[model samples]
Target: MGQLVRGVWTADADFPRDADGRFDRAASQFRDMHVEPVAGRYHLYVSLACPWAHRTLVARALLGLEHAIDVSIVEPVWQDNGWQFSDRYPDRLHGARYLWELYVRARADFTGRVTVPVLWDRERDTIVNNESAEILRLLHTAFAPLARTPRDLVPEPHRADIDAINARVYEAVNNGVYKCGFAGTQAAYDEAEAALFAALDELDATLAGRTWLVGDALTEADIRLFPTLVRFDAVYNIHFKCSRKRLVDYPNLLSHTVRMYRLPGVADTVDFDHIKRHYYLCHRSLNPRGIIPVTGQGAYLRLA
Candidate 1:
């Protein structure tokens, strides 16, 4: 676990934990919105390995902004210095050797944790936003004029409802898994695990006959939750110790995951290789051996 401090990358000795050993996540530093839709001006810097970053990728595709906004994928592995670049994994927009360079270029004296899903404003030579939630929102609405589809993931009428659900899902499930995985004590793990399963159970029961999280149409809430759910059984179950129940065990959740994956342009955004490697290798404290599990289960197995 590492972070950028005032534009300088600082390698964390361990995951950020509270006095009670509860995992505490840092707030995203860069948060800016695009006032006007501009094609070929915004670039997304993402790591296929990160669930937070994955949300933006899904949003970008769902909004059909593939041509409007360019994207650069970082390598799956994270080293001591943090996310670096290579010829094989070149920064498509700039030939910078590391992601930190982009941050430095944006603000030479900038200090904060360098996380992915960075929306770069090439015109201003600065970061539009690094927070996935904001990036997803901008992709969904700000670029509506340039989008290929007419669907609004966060429609005005559903905004309030979506926000409420997103907050719960984000706290209990989206971030709950991390709390469990990064927990340094049994009490911390128990607390996170209980909340995680409780949320999942409620969600499964709620989606018994529904196709989406919010009524009939799919919304931003689904996109926010999908990356975590999709990775739950595969990586989080074992590596993160979120094994109360596998995602496949939940009929509705599994079906919902498949439905989202089957959506046009979504499956392409998912890379199990990156997901597995990043979790198993990057989080050395969780898995010192760094051995990746090879379940016969392909990345996306149909829920049986």
Candidate 2:
């Protein structure tokens, strides 16, 4: 709803919606900067509540990048100036109050929406990339040499299959939930809801026989879809008007979620407190009184 114009923050409404009231997400701006993997040289800024950001967090953990690259979390509830740093999760890098401050610091003339999972180049004082998909690849490939575990999420033999699944999941599931939630018209909502469930139905059927999305082992496709599924029953199902069926209704999909959650480091990455607070309290339009439902958090006890 708000963005920076040439380094200056403005509260004006500049949503890119078509006449049909369908939301069009803006692309990340810091895409071309090259990030070289150097221990303690880069820091990741993320919000546990954000699905896109969650992808990077999980990748960082799975690849054992915690020792190489540190992370800072923003407050779950977005403020007027956007994602802010509170005393509980302060900006250890610059002591900046808001996430936008880091953007302005990186590029004084930068103009765009300030989103996370930001890969900050501490030595250069610039952003390497803000796109989570790109950041995930960076964590898996560029930083693979530094990983403590000998694993390849995007193995060369299965790269094609993994990419194919990622494309379908990104449109129909990853971003689809958002399309359902932010639809401004009944027709738009209906269209998004139909596409979302169709994809879920297809995915459930696909997973009925296999444990992973692309291959026997975990891949990028699984990492990309897990965030959305993990949040589906909690936020998207109710707050997003995706009421056709809860994620638990799809037995296979729910099984996949628990399997992924039970992974070595994956369980540690989830924060339902941040997840619930951000959605129910932050989106005032969707939740006028800021009342957070108490039903969703218990569903993740399997991870505990």
Candidate 3:
């Protein structure tokens, strides 16, 4: 519910909510992203719990950029200090204790949300990009020369289609869950929940008899949606008040989700432990007691 006011980190302020009690997200501040792809030149900072960050990881795995672009994972929970590295994921790059340190390191006067899926240029010692959507595209093509198994997730023929679908899914589904969870009023929550479920219903219907969202191949559109879908029932359904329907209720959508997770390297990125703990414990406004739920999430991974 807080962010950096100036160059300094502060939790003294409140989340930016509209008059209608709807949560309005801040736009990403870092831009002008151009990276020179080379081994050990770039790194990724991500949280396994974050769906947006998860998108870039999917592209990295799908495109075979494991060797070209290295990554460091942060702990699932966000504290007053923001995302911090844990014993399991200690900083291997700059050895910063907190993710904000990297931001300040990137730009001393930087002001905005300290978000994950950051593309860091080690040579320049700055963040190349923090936008997951853009980073995903970059991972798809930027390191192609170094990729062990290159695949164009965003093909030219379906680029426009992918963009169009991304816009829709991002609004009503990917970011929709946040809108539902952060809504300040009952009316706001209701409106967000309705839009989210409607989108899910449409997606379920669209995915019927189809293996992919656009064209005959898996593209960025599917990549964009999978992270949200994979975590939908695990957290969104109960935690975000996005309970009008479970993903299991939408058979096609459920199958689509399972198929995506089963994709090579995709399942490795799915972490319900991080997903559940993050939503139920990190956001104090939502779950003040900070008690983690026993959602029996293991079966989710075993699904075909």
Which parts of model 3 are misplaced by more than 4 Å? 12-14, 300-304
Each candidate structure's TM-score, on Cα atoms with residue i matched to residue i, is: 0.96, 0.96, 0.96
How far in Å is the alpha carbon of 159 misplaced in model 2? Answer: 1.4
What TM-score number comes out for model 2? 0.96
As for lDDT, the candidate ahead, 2 or 3, is: 2
Q: Candidate 1 has which clashing residue pairs, if any? A: 4-112, 4-113, 5-111, 6-110, 6-111, 6-112, 7-110, 7-111, 7-112
Q: Provide backbone clash counts, one per model.
A: 9, 0, 0
| Residue range 120-222, candidate 2, lDDT tens digits | 9988888989999999988988888788874789999999999999999999889888888888899988998999999999999999989998888999999
lDDT of each: 0.87, 0.88, 0.84
Pairs of colliding residues, candidate 2 = none
- The residue-by-residue lDDT of candidate 1 on 29-70, one tens digit each, is 788875469899989999988999999999888888999999
Model 3 vs. true fold: TM: 0.96
Roughly what TM-score does model 1 have, to 2 decimal places? 0.96
**Tens digit of per-residue lDDT, candidate 3, span 70-137:** 88999988888889897889888999898988899888887888889889898888888888888887
Worst 10 residues of 2 by lDDT: 295-304
